[model samples]
Structures are given as C-alpha cells and as structure tokens.
Target chain A: MIDTLIWLVALPLASALATQLLPRYATAIVISTAIATSINAAALLYAVATHGVMLYQIGGWTAGLGIALRADGLSALLLMMAAIVLLASSIYASAYFNDNPLRRRFWPLWLLLWCSLNALLLSGDLFNLYVTLELLGLSAVALASLGGKTAALQAALRYLLVGLLGSMLFLAGVTLIYAGYGTLDLATLSRVVAAGPIAWSALALMTVGLLLKTALFPLHFWLPPAHGSAPAPVSAVLSALVVKATFYLVMRLWLDIFSEVVTPQAASIPGVLGAAAVLWGSWQALRAERLKLLAAYSTVAQLGYLFLFFPLLQALPAGAARDAAMGGLVILALTHGLAKSGLFLAIGIIQQRSGHDTIRDLDGTAQRLPATTFAIALSGIALIGLPPSGAFLGKWHLLAAAFSAGQWLWVVVIMIGTLLAAAYTFRVLGHAFGQQPYPRHPVTIAAEEWPALILSAFATIGLGLAGAPVWQLLKVSL
Target chain B: MLTAHWLYGLSGCLIMTFGLRAVLLNDSLLQRIIALNVMGTGVFMILITIAYRGPDAAPDPIPHALVLTGIVVAVSATALALTLIRRLTEEQDND
Candidate 1:
C-alpha cells in the first residue's frame, strides 16, 4: 500500500520530468500525463475508500529521523480534487492551445504543477513542504508570466518577490523549530514541542508568513492582478491549488503541532479577517466589470469562508466540531475547487467567443453559448449556497455549527456572504439573459467550451447526487 | 570553533540585507536575479551554520543536505528566469 502511495506521487513527477526533457511528443506527453494523473486520483479515492489512512516513510527510516508521508481523509480528498481539476484542465489545455506556439511550454509546466501538488500533499515534514512550496511558486510565476504582456510580467514579478520573502520567513521559522527541538517532522514535533517564547516566535513568524502567502485580507495586494489577468487555465490552477497550499499547511500545522498555541482570542483574528475578506471581496466582486476580475475577487471572498471553519472548529464541541467545522471547510474547498476552476474555464471560452470577458461587453454570449450559460447558472447555484450543491451542504453544516456554538456573528457573515454571492452570480446570469447584440468579433472556439461546461455542471449538479457518499467518504476527518 | 557560528551568521545577515535591497530597489531584471542568487547564498550560509551545531553526532546533516538541494534548485530556477527575461526583452523590442 505504501509502495502504491509512492507510485502515486512518483508517476506524475517522472512524467513531468520526461515531458520537460522531451518536447516534441506533445500529444503523447499530454496523454501520458492524463493517464498518470487519473490513475493517481483513482488510487487516492481507493485509499480513502478502503483504508482509513495511508503512510509512507522516506529512505526506510523511522518517523522522527526520516521524512514521513501520511494521508488521512483530508489529504486524500484534496488530492482527488486536485487530480480531477488538473485532468480536466489538461484536457481543456490540449485543445485550447493547439495552434498556439507555447503549447510545448504549457504541457511541461502543467505537468510540473501536477508533480509539485502531489509532492506537497505527500510531504510529511516542514522542510519537504518548503521545497515543494517553492516548486509550486516558481512554476506558478512562470505560468502567470506566460501571457508575455507587461501586465502579466509585472504581476508575476510581484508574485515572485512576495513568494520568495514568504519562503524565507518560513525557512527561518523551520530553522527555529529544528533548533528548539532538534526535529522538524510533524508527528515528532507534535509530541516534543513545549510552550515557550522561542516556539511562540516561530509560530508567529510562520503564521504571518503563511497568511501573507495565502493572501489573507490585508496582505492580498498581489492576488487580484495575478489571478485576474492570467490566462484562464492558469487562473484555474492558481485558484484551485496554489493558494490552498498555504491554507492547507496552516491547517495541518495548527491541528498537528500548534494545538496549544491557538488561544480563543487569537483564533478569532481569522474570523474577523475572514469576515472582512468576505464583505470586502464580495463588495469588490459586485462592482467589478470584467468577468474574470469578479471571479478573482470572489476567490478572495471564498477564502474567507474557508477561514470561518478555523474559528468554528475551535469553538464547537469535539465530536460535532470535527464533522461540521472541519468537514464543512473540506467540502467548501472541494466544491470551490470544482466550481471556481469551471468558472474560469467557462469565462475563458466566453472570452474567446466574444473576444472579451468584460461584463458590459458580454452581450448575447449566453444565447450563443448556451452550454456555457448552463455552466455558469449551475456554478452560480453552488456559489450562492443554494440547495443541491456542495456549497449548500457545507453552508448548512457550518450554519448548524455556528448556531450550535452560539456564534451569531459568524452566522451574520455567512448570511451576508451568501447574499453577496447570489448577487454577483445572478448579476452574470441576469446579464446573460438580457437582450443585447453579440460583439462583432469573428471567433474560433470549438475546443474550449466543453470542459468548462462539464466541470461547472459537475460542481453544481454532482454535489447534490453525490452528497451521501461525500459525507460518508469524509467521515474520516483530519 | 565557537567563533565560526557567529561569523557565518553575521555574514549571512549582511548578504541577506543586500538581497533585500536588490529586491526592493533594482529595476534591472538581471540585477534582481543576481541579488536573488546572493540571497540564496545567505540562506545557504545560515543553513550551514545551523547544521554545524558544535560538531557532535553527525553535525545535524539534514540542513546541509537541504542546502545542497536548495542550491541546485535555485540555479535551475535562475536559468529559467534568465531565459524568460531575455525573451521578454526581445518581445518588448519587437513591439
């Protein structure tokens, strides 16, 4: 089982390396990547289905001495989500960039991203996480700059600078941990670490660094430009996976190592920031003109919803807390991954057909691109927390958790976020329905439309159908 | 020697200050890369200093191993970024 787990990571990594070195067989390379990624996803799902957890040790060494790779329900679920989105993106990418010259670079970077994500999920030590985070950051910068426009390059440069500084801060924190306790592995650090000024300083440094990297409310200066302006597929991956890494690490670090550090007062900061992010990001989303910018700002908002789970998890009772609090965010992460990536892709297709993603300019796109319209409508239901989507299920559990814990302020934020979400989602939907002439630009867009609609349809409709299994599957929480 | 740790740490601190300066003030892309490399060197120095730890019990070689890996990865990324910078300049020139 452990060897199988290693193979799950190894396959994509090897494929990525092979693709980078051999650039001529672009089609075959993509096919190989798809097969490998699909197999990895299925294997993760299977691991979740049968075994409660999966573990692997590096270099055949023991846990404290060597790096360990362990996947509980949380890791497995996110890995599967990443795999599905990446596979879809790869398929969509294969067709979308057929005539573009940079298709070669696209395939390799995409594969490398897949590799980095798997490595990130599988890493068991802080040091290993840092390495994979750097890999993820570098590739994202390269891919964002792939647009070659000065705007994108400038955004990429900003992302790169911020990413490096964050990495350095993280590295310094890791060094402190190793110095303080002579171990950097999570399982060991959890057992041995004591509350002290050294550990607190390390935690503070790491918390600030990860929050900056994750683009939490005030530190989010670079995200809108980087995400809003990137190519559609690039935006999809960035939203679906990149930012999640920082949050994922924070979640893991808190649950596994920083249990003592999470004071009730300290935990509320995320809630406060989360609320601010929700209101501020939603307000911006409502006012934005470009479809992609709306979606990007919505990302900033959606990120707030994820953080709500943190404070909720702290406040709720243990048994229910694990299920409602953590489970709600897990579902939110998965659903948002599906829906946001789908939204980006759909917006991409619409942009190609209409030659723009501007709200005012999206005249008659819904009429001409009915599949894309259905895609947007379906994704909107989930986005707005309407029933029969994973977002609704997540919000339902989260609401129960909040009310049960008597956190009415959280309840208020959730309500306001829902209304704001509905407002923006329907703003696009209403625009889609309004009578306006299509733009005059001639368009070529056969390859782009299907994947976006398929992904969005799954995000909206599949959540309802798959609810029972998803609940059952995630019963084994972090 | 006891003096080695402080010496390496101080030098690392100095080089990192310059790296920070490069990242903040430099407009030239190549200069930024050079500063980034210098920053990597500072980090490498710190890693090595931490790995030393009084010369007992294999000297905590993990950070050492990570530093070597970091250097290789940094060089690879630098090569890629340089190429991108060149391509970007060419595109700008063309336009």
Candidate 2:
C-alpha cells in the first residue's frame, strides 16, 4: 500500500530527473513512466476503494512534524482522472511532436508537472500543498512557453505572474491560519478552526487566491490566451489538469477543512461569480473565431458548473441531497477533465492538418478526418450535458438538489448555460461537415486519434453507463 | 507587548496591499514581476511573525520551514518569469 503511494509520486519525479540527465531516451523514459504511474494510480485508487481513506505518515512522524500523504475517495478519483488524461496526452504528444526539436525538453517538464499534480492531490499538509502548487505552476508555465512563439511566450509570462501572485496570497492566508491556530496541517487545522475574524480573513484570502488560479470568471482573462497559444498537449494538461487542481484545493478547503468557517453570504459570492462565468464564458465561446479559443472558453464555462454546486450544497441539509450535489460536482469535474483533454487533443490534430484552428477554415480539414471530428462530436456531447453523458447525469443531480432546495434561479442559470453550450459546440461541429464529400480514407495520424477517441468515449458513454461505482465512491466522505 | 503582534500583522497586510496594487497597476512586465516578489516577501514576513512565540519559548519551526520553502518557490518563479520576459524581448528584437 505504502509502496503504491510512494511510487505514485516518485516514478514521475525519477523519470523527470532521468530525462534531464540522459536527454536521448527522454521519450522512452516518459512513456514508460507514464504507463507505470497510471498503473500505480490505479492501484492507489483500488486501495482507497476497498480500504477507505488511506493515510501514510512520512518518516514515522505522525501529525505535527512529518508530512502526511492521504488518499480519500475524492483524491483517488482525481488521481484516476489525471492518470487517464495524462496517459492519453503522453501518447498523443509522442506522435504529435515526433519530429519537433523541443520534444525532448517537453518530456522532463511534463513529467515534473505530473509529479506535482499527484503530490498535490495526495497532500495532507497546507504548506506542502503550497509547495506542490508552485512546482506545478512553474512547470506548467515552462511548458506553455515551449512553443516559443511571441504569443505563447507572452501568455506564459502572464500566467506565471498571476500564478505567483496567487501563491503569495495563499501563503499569506496560511500564515494567518498558523497565527490563529498554530498548525499547518489541514487535518489538524480543520479540527481546531472556528468562525472568527482571523479564520474568515484566512479563508477569504485563500479562496480568492485559489479562484484566481482556477481562472473562474472575471479572473479568466489569462487562461484563453495561454491555453489557446500553447502546443495542444500543453493546453490539454493546463485546461484539464492544472486549473482543476486549484479548484480541487478550494473545494477541499471549503467542504472538508474549513466547513466550520463557511458562511452563507461568503458561499454565495462564488455562486454568483459562477453564474456570471457560465453566461459570459459560454457567450464568448459561441463567438470564438478559433477552435482552440472556443475550447478554452468552454473550459471557463464548464468550471462554472463545479462552483454552482456550492450554493445548493450550502442550502441543502445534511442528507442524500447534499451528498448527491457534492457527487454531481465531482462527476462534473471528472467528465470535464476527460472531455476537455480529448477535445484539445482532437483540436491539435485538426490544427496540425489545417495549419490553423479557425473554425471557418477547419471545414475542409475536418471533412477529411472523420475520426477527429467524431472525437469532437463525442466530447462536445458531454460538454453540452446532453442525455446519456456523464455531464447529463451530474447536472440531473445538480438540478434536483436546486429544485428541492427552492433555488430556481440556479435552475434557470443552468438551463441558459446548457443552451449556450449546445449552440457553441455545434457551431464548431457544423463546420466540420461540408457539402462536398471528401474522400474517407484512413487518417495517417490514427495513433494520435485513438487516445482521444478512447478518452471521449469514457467521458461520454463510459461514465454515463457506469454511475453506481462513482456514486459509491462519493459516498465515502466529503 | 500586546500591540506587537497586531502591529506586525497590520504592516504585513499593508505591504501586501502595496505589492498587489503595484502588480495590478504597473504596465511594465518587469515591474509586475518585482511587485510579485515583493508580495511574496510580505507573505514570508507574516509567516515569520506568526512563528514568533514569547521571549522565553522556542519559536515554532513549522512556520519557519514553511517560510523557507516559500522563499525557494518565490526565487524559482522569479527566475522563470524573468527568463520568459527576456525571451519575449529577444523574439521581438529579432522581428
């Protein structure tokens, strides 16, 4: 058990370091490590599934002095989602960047980013999470600029500055928490935390910092540019994995550690911002000229669904309803992770074929590659929360919880968001099929397309068909 | 004696505000990076203040350790940001 926990993080770090030292075998090392890490992640998920929450104290020092790694049901689910998305991304990238000179440099940083993500998800300490966040931020920024275009470099710069600012605010909040409670461990802090000025200030600072990092709504200005300009694999990881990590931390802080410190008014703030994000983000997405920009805006819109659960959760009393709402939020996150990564990967193929991602120009290219179009169509269905998709199931619970709690305003918001999502998604797909029938020969990039197809299938049919296991996992705890 | 903690805390907050304002208001990328580092320094200062105990008691090592890690992170981020900024400038120059 402990070995799985250790290797889940260690394998990536080892491969990252090894890649830096022996640059020739970077691809071989990264691919093998990605496969190994995903296996370990699966093992960790299985362990958490059967045994419940697993905690490992480092160096035999429990609680106060030593760091702790924990794998609750939520962490396990996130680990699995990350593993699948990253493995697919690695495979797609191997083919996508087969001849690019920057391919070797990409491997090591990507591994480091993966390592930090696993560490952040498993971390039980607040300070340790801060370290992991910084590590993730740096590597992600480096990868974002790997394309080295003026636009990519500029976007990476902006992302870096904002990310550092966010980390600083988070650290300041941690300082206050330590001042008020004298502990930096999340589990310990949760026990001792209470509603007071210090706690409120600390929570507010941390939440705002996380919101900025998550790029929720008004703070999302930096995301579209960065995600749109990066090489597609980097964009996929950033959109699907990086932002979600911060959001996960915010959810963890609110729902688990700082639940005592939460107030109705404070919770509504995010709910309000989430609604705006849904509306504005979807509108922008509908008007986006470039397919990559559309995907980025869709990410902004999709993240709003996660936050919309907050108000409903706060309004519902402790029972099946609140649990379902929380479960819905997790399902939404997982689905978005899978679906978004697949969408970006498909877009990468389209861009490579067409030499650009403008939705208008992609018509001829898309007509040529049916597999990529199908990947987009499949993921787009999930993204739009159409019937029989995991997002549909998630939104069903969200709407149920909202209606039961008498929160009809949120229902209207979700409906509007869904309509906008459908419009924008099909707008791109509408361009894919031209009046002229292009020859339907097998795509040369079939290897790259398969992972995306597999991922979209999981996002749509796989999760949609299998709800009992996910519901069972969400039942473990907050 | 009572006012010392509040004094330190308020000053830390003020410095943070200044840094944040500078980061948001500055047009120059270099100034924003500088502002970010300053903000990090303010946070580190707050952390150090939080670690302070009574004159006789041993200060908590945890916050100190946290501050050290924060410093390392801050330095690495600064270096990366500066490098990106340099690369952008060079790309523009070549153009």
Top TM-score: which candidate number? 2
Residue A347 in model 1: shift from native, Å?
Answer: 0.7
**Model 1 residue A37 CA deviation in Å:** 2.2
State the weakest 10-residue window (summed lDDT) of model 2 chain A: A435-444
Instruction: Candidate 1: give the clashing pairs.
Output: none
Residue A394's lDDT within candidate 2 is: 93
- Structural similarity of chain A in candidate 2, as TM-score: 0.98
For model 1, residues A67-159, the per-residue Cα lDDT tens digits are 888777777777877887887887778776777888877877877777788788878888888888888888888888885686777678778
Chain B TM, per prediction: 0.88, 0.92
Off by over 4 Å in 1: A436-447, A470-478, B1-45, B55-58, B78-95
Candidate 2 clashing pairs? none
Chain B TM-score, candidate 2?
0.92
In order, what lDDT does every prediction score?
0.79, 0.88
lDDT score of residue B61 within candidate 1: 71
Model 1 alpha-carbon miss at residue B30, Å: 6.5
Q: Write the per-residue lDDT of candidate 1 for residues B1-95, one digit (tens) a residue.
A: 46888898788868866886786689887888788778778777877887785755457778888888778877877786777677767767877
